[model samples]
Target chain A: TQLLEQSPQFLSIQEGENLTVYCNSSSVFSSLQWYRQEPGEGPVLLVTVVTGGEVKKLKRLTFQFGDARKDSSLHITAAQPGDTGLYLCAGGGVNAGGTSYGKLTFGQGTILTVHP
Target chain B: NAGVTQTPKFRILKIGQSMTLQCTQDMNHNYMYWYRQDPGMGLKLIYYSVGAGITDKGEVPNGYNVSRSTTEDFPLRLELAAPSQTSVYFCASSYSASGRAYEQYFGPGTRLTVT
Candidate 1:
């Protein structure tokens, strides 16, 4: 079984502060995705990284995939109160049959509370 | 489009009771997934379907069942509810190609409590 360990399970920061969330795993994945979920709602996709050592940016958030495809990171620059939410990272892999089942192993999630 | 929709946003079921969580996607995505989220556990896949008439088990499938009879609907059934089964259920859909990764659209989620 594949497992994802995320660091900083709880984060509380004031507005304009920058923070980073890390997701590490021992198993390799074909792709990694970041999602942000608000209270009472399902997670919303933030970004997807498919290549090793790949980086993607969306507005104030930057995502990076490790060279081994076993780890990833999310960095928020100048965070705001609106950035408060549960951030999740999920790793996607193909089965032995070479089928991309779209099954994802998710991290425990980091709950970010950005005070204004 | 109503990317994905789930019914009964919140529900409370007694032990041994059975219920079906309804999910529908208007995007006609071929890949649909059912996952449960606990307090500390992020999201565990309960079941998934690649297309209509095809379903497979995920990491945690012991107490749940699912069916995909159409491209639009994939409902999850829980029989003999247990307190351990209380969690928030999310339904998601994606248009998957063979090797490429696609974005999955999720429903608001169903909060179920079994006592």
Candidate 2:
């Protein structure tokens, strides 16, 4: 079973539309990260949320960590064609040494296509 | 810095063949990871190394082996290729310090196909 689950496997919307992607899990995580990947390239880190119920905004995008730390949501306002890409969410537990072993569990990913 | 570098941008292997995927990082990070991603799926961790001479298995370690003889290099070896092993492989590294961890830097990736 996938440790983390993402909703809306694929999304297609016109530019200037609003959209939200969800990432859910049953297990709790010490930290969760969001990444965006373009075609033929590795995913790039977008945001990291460690505290429960924390909300972080990056310009037109807003990310929120569920109060239970078991879910996350990414909302985009007035999306643009440049926002088109695959969004991934990854989670991992904390290590005793305070440094995780780099074994992060990733979601299936959401491919978002914003048409101009 | 080169960050994380993976050699052989693409490779085609026949069944039963053996080859090693090379990974090297110039960031001097203490943690390195190998992950495989199938089409339309998320990346699954295969192996990871904490430092030189310390290696550990991940969720999907089957059919793969790794060796970390130095802090800069972590190589993944496939003893016998199989069609099920064909996928995109990525190598990433992160700098982990006391109570803080940095984001992982990934390479351009190596696409391997086994027939």
Candidate 3:
């Protein structure tokens, strides 16, 4: 089974503090996606990184995919209270037989709390 | 568009009861998925359908069933509700072509409790 292990399941920081969440696995994936979810709502997609060693930045957030395609990370800069939420990393792959398209395996997720 | 919509935002059921969770997407997505999220955990796929009339079991498919009669609807069925079945259910849809990365749109989610 392909598994993605997320570190620091819980995080609390003051506003403007920076934090980084990591997702690691032993299995290689075709793509990786990041999502942020609020309480009582479903997760919203933040970004997807496919190429190895690729980096994408969205304002205050930066995401990177490992060169081996077995890990990914999300780094937040100057986090605000509004940035507090559940951050999830999902690895995407197709079945070996190529029957199922875009199957995803998700990590436990990181709960970030940014105190104002 | 409505994206993906799930019915019965909240529900309570007793042991041995059965219910169906409805999910619909107006985007005409070709891929639909059902997932369950336990408290303080990540979402686990229960079932998925590649298109109308094509369905397959996922990681945690035990005690659950799904059907896709139309392109836009995929409903999940719980045969016997158990305490372990209590969790938040989410429906997602995606459209993929070739090798490009596709985004999965998620519904608000349905909270289910079994006593």
Best by lDDT: 1
lDDT of 1 by residue, A16-111 (tens): 999999999999988899999999999999999988999999999999999999999999999999999999999988445647668888999999
For residues B33-102, write the lDDT of model 1, one tens digit per residue. Answer: 9999998789999999999999999989998999999999999999999999999999999865436566
- The whole-model lDDT of each prediction reads 0.92, 0.88, 0.92
What DockQ does each listed candidate score? 0.66, 0.64, 0.66
Which clashing pairs does model 3 show? none
Candidate 2 wrongly placed segments (more than 4 Å): A97-99, B97-102
* lDDT (10s digit) by residue, model 3, range A1-116: 89999988999999999999999999988788999999999899999988899999999999999999999999999999999999999988844655547778999999999999
Q: Which 10 residues in a row give candidate 3 chain B its minimum summed lDDT?
A: B95-104
- Candidate by candidate, in order, the iRMS in Å equals 1.6, 1.7, 1.7
Predicted candidate 2 versus true structure: per-residue lDDT over B41-105, tens digit per residue: 89999999989999998889999999999999999999899999999999999864324334677
Report lDDT (Cα) of residue A71, candidate 3. 97
